[model samples]
Target: MATDDLNKPLGLPRERKAHRTPLVALVAPPLLIAIGLIAFFAFGDGPDDPGNVVAAIDDTSPDQTGSVGPALTPVYEAQSEPLVEVKPTGGLREVRGNDVIISDPSKPRPIRLAAAPFEDLIEADENGLLPRIGDDGTRPLDAYARPAGATEGMKRIAIVVGGIGIEGEAGQSAIASLPGEVTLGIVPYGEDLPATVAEARALGHEILLQLPMEPYNYPDIDPGPNTLTVAGGTAKNLDRLRWLLAQTTTYVGVMNYMGARFTGDDRALAPILGDIADRGLLFLDDGSSARSRVGAFASDSAPVIRADLVLDGDTAPAAIDARIKQLVAIARERGYAVATATAFPSTIARISAFARVAEENGIALVPVSSLVRADGS
Candidate 1:
């Protein structure tokens, strides 16, 4: 039913580096240094190389290490005309080409820094094909992510009830019944995806898109229309993926619907995983099959956190309760645990009741994101 962080470099095209007016350009460091040395030694000025004059006014900032060597610095040739002398009127001002500009010192300069935090870096296109995140410095997925909210010594348990939005009423009930900390997975075919997402967000539960990928049964037991398949090849699969992604927004990640066969094939899953990584989203394995390649494929390309347990494989009240207890035990033993289940009414009731009581036992039920890697790496 359900569904994961870690960065596999998404390789999204680099946003233009922010254009900054460097401190040297404004302060004329080279000019000041040259003037000072001359004044101290011979009480006279040195010959002004137009190259040095332009270099002194260079707005190019430092490199990755914040140090620039001459080889790395851009060389602006001396124009046939002599270099123009720029007088500082005060504040932040720099020379570009032959013109000198002045900026108000009191006002803040606008810098659309690509390397800024996630909130600043995320930009939604009009089509919203597949949203992309900026460099590793900005992880919108992690910024919008959830923490366990557990006490210092509490064992954390995170669960996701998948298959929401397929059967409308059933989906609604699952959203209302389950605690907000429990994550919900929505199908792309939902009659009203936006409304469902809005209601789920209102309830404080994080949403994930459930993609229908091919299963072992194939045509005999189809998950849904447009199931991602190896036969579709990488290009077609990505096209299908774009459609699924367009259905909603603010979802933290995506998980497979019935992808046992499709997920196991690396040739089919690798490119898909890369796309997921490229976007600022997580990937949940659902742990539906032992042979699923999501775990290994994720570790190598896009890292994922596979479910530690399937909460309602048997859907019976007693079975679900037992699984909750087992999950709590595992969490207590391992410090954190992850579980996935369908939206069966009985399953929902049993796990909800167990989650309420588990807290009294020092087990903190957390959002599924608690198990995700924060840096999305």
Candidate 2:
């Protein structure tokens, strides 16, 4: 107290030091923290390290074990030409061409077996028409055969060989010449209508009888000797219709040869429509005239519509081509269209061209029944 009393206030011992000594110690911890934060912000993880996030999620470090497994790639081989794969069956096999592939090892592989080649369904003649196979054998004309150059679910064109003066062996030959998908429209004018009907049934083709009806402005045009008319009144007309239907035993439906006059009168045609509906048969209008009430009557009869716009009034190649284009255009606008032409060779060629157009355009060519069935559905 005596020595330090001059410098101190007489209560405590004097200890003098730098002004900032304690302050330095106190602020050192916060200053160090600030420096550490700056360093972290400047040099922490960044995009330069691509593996930072991806590697973290995938965990695909270079040190991982076990193989990742083989990479998948398509397996297709070069071929000289298109190959047709044929599976072995238990019957005699007849491969028509050398390019046909007997078996392929890449797939599950076809089981090899012995079987006979398919016998020709119809015995073909010079022009590709087939004769009735045998006296007892049924004729083999199916309406829904596979189409020419067809894949699964493709539309087909149907044609029948019996309507236009084709009979017996000649008729069979024409039917055979037709592609399998054509519907066989048979007229009863052949030598033996029943026999011809039997043959058509055997061919697996759809059979429909052509009904004779009264046409406008052409009363002399004969559908057949026994035809229905408005002149007969209700009972007689019904009887005549029943008889006409009975003429062909296995026809699934009927189309008018010419009926502009009779169809205009609903009173005369209603009973006939009832008979057709009662039999579960379809009515095809042929769309002869716009005024034809066949469509109007079909609502009650559950009738099918035939949207035929292309008759190819002329069979010239260019004319036929134009009509076909018109047909496709109409088909694209509507869901579908149906047109019929005579059985002349020129007509056949024209239709064949139209079929090609249908293929190119991805249009379907289904049967008349398909059109009818669609309405019911």
Question: Which candidate wins on lDDT?
Answer: 1
Q: Could you give candidate 1's per-residue lDDT for residues 1-377 as a string of tens digits?
A: 11101212255643456656678785796799988877755532234332333333333222221122121223334664333344433223444553434333543222111112244534555535445675665444565554445357888887888888886677888877676678889888888877787777655577778999999878898888788987889999988888788777767788899888998899999989888877767888888889888877655336477888798889789888888878888888988888899988888788767766776799877777656763345
In order, what lDDT does every prediction score?
0.69, 0.50
**Highest TM-score scorer:** 1
Compute the lDDT for candidate 1. Answer: 0.69
Regions of candidate 1 where Cα sits further than 4 Å from its true position: 1-129, 135-137, 299-301, 374-376
TM-score of 1: 0.65
Across 1-377, the per-residue lDDT of candidate 2 in tens digits comes to 37546656467866776344477886897899999988856654333532221100111111111111121212222343222233223222453332222222332211111111113323333323222223443222212222223234443333332353344454564344433334456664556666665544343345556677777665567666656677878888766666566554545567766677887778877887776665556667666666667777676345545546535468688887786677666666765567655555655555555554555566755555655654461
lDDT of 2 at 83: 24
The regions of model 2 sitting more than 4 angstroms off are 1-174, 198-204
Each prediction's TM-score versus the true structure: 0.65, 0.55
